[model samples]
Target chain A: MLSDIAFLFYFFSLFISFIGSCIMFSKIEIAFKWIGILLIVTFLNELNTRFLVKSLSIQSNGVYHFFVPIEFSIYTIIFATFINLKRWNKILILLVFLLVIIEILNTLFLQPIYVTNTNTMIIESVFLVLLSLILYIRIKESTYYKNLLLEGVFWFNSSILFYYAFNILVWGFHNWDFINPPLIMYDINAFLCGLMYLTFLFSIYLNFIQVRKLKN
Target chain B: MTNRQIESIDVIVFIVAGILVILLMFGFILYFLISYKSKKRDYNLLEIQKKELDDQKKLLENTLSELRATQSQLIHSEKMASLGQLTAGIAHEIQNPLNFVNNFSDVSKELLTEMREDIKKNNIEDALELASDVVNNLDKIYFHGKKAESIVKGMLQHSRAAKGLLEKADINLLCDESIRLAYHGMKSKFMDFNVEITTIFAQNIPKIYIIPQDIGRVILNILSNAFYATIQKSKKISSDYKPNVTIKTLYDSSGVNVYIRDNGCGIPQEIKDKIFQPFFTTKISGQGTGLGLSICYDIINSHGGRISFESKEREFTEFNIFLPNKSNLVVKIPNNVV
Candidate 1:
């Protein structure tokens, strides 16, 4: 029953994100559109992994290995748009793409595909938090000082920061199996996912409102 | 993997991640606050610079207008001084003509009385001769009277404040009249003063478009300076000193040129450039206002013309005034004449 409730909460968040993206699709900037697309992709990834694991009784570790690196690349690209340094932005995107490629190769050949890629996930989470931190610093030092509360990207990065920062512990404990797992842990995990999607919904909606205000 | 190993790894990872998050959060907050403070400081500095620029612009505008007002005041003062000096010469010039008219009238009166006496004695031929003599004497009186009237008319024209308006002026006549007025002026001011004046006016010189009154003042100014210089030279050298001023007017396709040369104490090379500057004079403090040449230069320059001088110290000085016949005027001489 609790798993069913967690599933409902996760899908509910995704539905909200879908509505937010649709609302802003025609009016938002290119960078902002990429963010909406990323939200849809995340929802699809979660749906596919759940279907394969529950119905087919197949492990979703391989799916995660493939999806994780791509997600990192997309997030890096989204943040790169926020960076004002022209040459450095391209360099940073290229560096992150190369790193993702290396991690995928390591997972396919060196590590077993059946096992959870816990160590790599922890590294990815830490790296993502670092990138979000870099973005925070850049925004602070910018000459075109925007109010952090008004900016969609600020909230988006902050969501990324909090999610990855706390998820590092979950990745570390992925191998553990207690006799009776604490129900609260699963609920907390669902709550974190819900928070991330809600943040996405809010950011996309804010972008739509801002664009409309500018048009008027 | 054993639950013991997994739990141990989780404990270590959680501690590291927690510490890193705490440090990053602190750093980000600190940096944001500092950047905000710096941005506020930069905005304040920019505002101060903008205000300073506005103040500087206002100061420059005030100074420019004050300079313009002072310039017109100086020109007016110089014009008045020139008029005052010409008044003395006009008075002296009219005196000779009036004396001749008076003498001729008295002689004609005597001849008329003699004609009446001869007619009473029946001397008809003698009476007719006396009548002819009286008529000649009356003609003399009429000629002198007209001469005095012309002098007064010329002086009136000179005395009027200049309009500085360009017109088709006979350049030769203008120069001759200025020379006469200037020479008579110096003679009236100093009784013992005498200078040999020579004028070579080009005949049929095309009428040059000019501000006659302004150019007339310029001509008078240069002539007076030339006369004054020669007078000084004459006083210094007792022997072989013949004060002479020669004026020549020439014309070409380009323009009309007037040359006023004098045998005088020439301009020293050291002070040559300073001559055209306002308030610079070689004369004793009270004798000269020192604005003569500067005003002459300004007047010529305003008419799209130029005034320059060539001089050898203690020998001779020649001033050349060239007026272009072109219509493009650089300076807008005001039409209001006071």
Candidate 2:
């Protein structure tokens, strides 16, 4: 029953984020609309993870298999950089588009259909860390953009950090149980992903509100 | 792990998320309230300042109008003083001639009475000659006395105090009367010049609320300037370019506009602006006191009006006077009532 309530909260958050995206599209400004689109996509991706887990009967290993940490990390870095270095919008746009293409390719082709290997996880985790570092650098340099973008980066990066650290701990020190664990690490991952998507949605909403104020 | 343990963990996470969301919402509400309060305070301050500014403007306008009225009163007083002096001199001049007419007419009456008595007693020859002589003396007294009386009457009318008795007066009647009075007064002093006066009065002008005599004086002053300009120009140019003065009246949204234009050697552009200043004149020394246009300016301003002029050297000069209409009921009030 409690798990069902958490699922409901996650779904409610997704609904709000989707409505916020629609508001951005209704606005005339291109920058706000694009940021809103990015938030909706990230939320949808997170929602799909939960749906796949339930409908496909994807166990813990299946959960880790299909979802790539690299995608969120890259988006976080690109959005943070875009907010910070708007003067280089043309170059940043090109770079982000290329990274998205690479992410799609890797997700579709590189990893096996049902593998949960530590090597594959570490490789994806390293790319995420690199992306997080770039995002952190942008947040450090920007003054006005720091507060909002930093909140998004903090949620996403901390989630990635916790997931990777816990994984490493469980694999290296603790007895590996195939069926169940001492802690609900999967639930924690789900909660953190929900938080990351919520923060991203809030940041996009903030951008749209600021643009609307300027237009008025 | 039991199902109870999983439920407990889920409850803890859910409670924490709910608390965080409530806290964030509270913070946003607080921010909005503070911003709205500050903006309302700023708007109130601006409204107060605007009200204060409007009050100050009204006060300033009142003071300015009062100052103008006082200035005109001073000018009127000065005019009265000068007119009083002229009146004394004119009265003395007319008195001598009048006394001679009166004394001669009395003597002629006595002579005719004696002649009638002699004719009744049958002294025909002496009575006839005496009667003819009495008749000739009566004719002389009648002609001279009538002439002197007309001159004195004209002088009295010209020098009358301007009580500023505002009334609905016809502009054409006022203009013609003023020009006639001014010509009668000044023509004898300045000889050998035929000044052409033309009136281009607009037909069907509504009766304007103004002091007829005061406005007449203003027109007379402008005409005097035109005549002076013509005299000055005649010295340099041929007599063929005959001097002409024109008075025109028109009405529009801005009330009645009177234009007094002259084709005399126009005022120099440099001195044109100064012409309306008190005691500023281009006339030769001792010929003019130079208070004319200044008085005109004061009169028009007191009527809630303005006077402006345009002049081109040796071409033409035009003075435009704009007077507000009856809609300005406050200004239309008589001075005594106000």
Who wins the DockQ comparison? 1
TM-score per model (chain B)? 0.76, 0.54
Best candidate (score: lDDT): 1
Put down candidate 2 lDDT per residue, A101-216, tens digits, no spaces.
55445446763445454444545544444544455445444433323333434444444444444334333222243333434444444454455556656656556566667788
- Candidate 2 CAPRI-style tier: incorrect
Question: What tens-digit string does per-residue lDDT give for candidate 1 at B80-114?
Answer: 77877787777777888899888888888898899
True contacts kept of each: 0.14, 0.00
- Please give, as one word, the docking class of candidate 1: incorrect
The global C-alpha lDDT for each of the candidates, from Candidate 1 onward, is 0.78, 0.62
Cα lDDT tens digits for candidate 1, A1-216:
777788688788887887778777888876678788888788889889889999998998778777777777777778778765788677777767776776777677755678667666777788888888888778766655446666787778778877787676565444353343334445656767787888887888888888999999
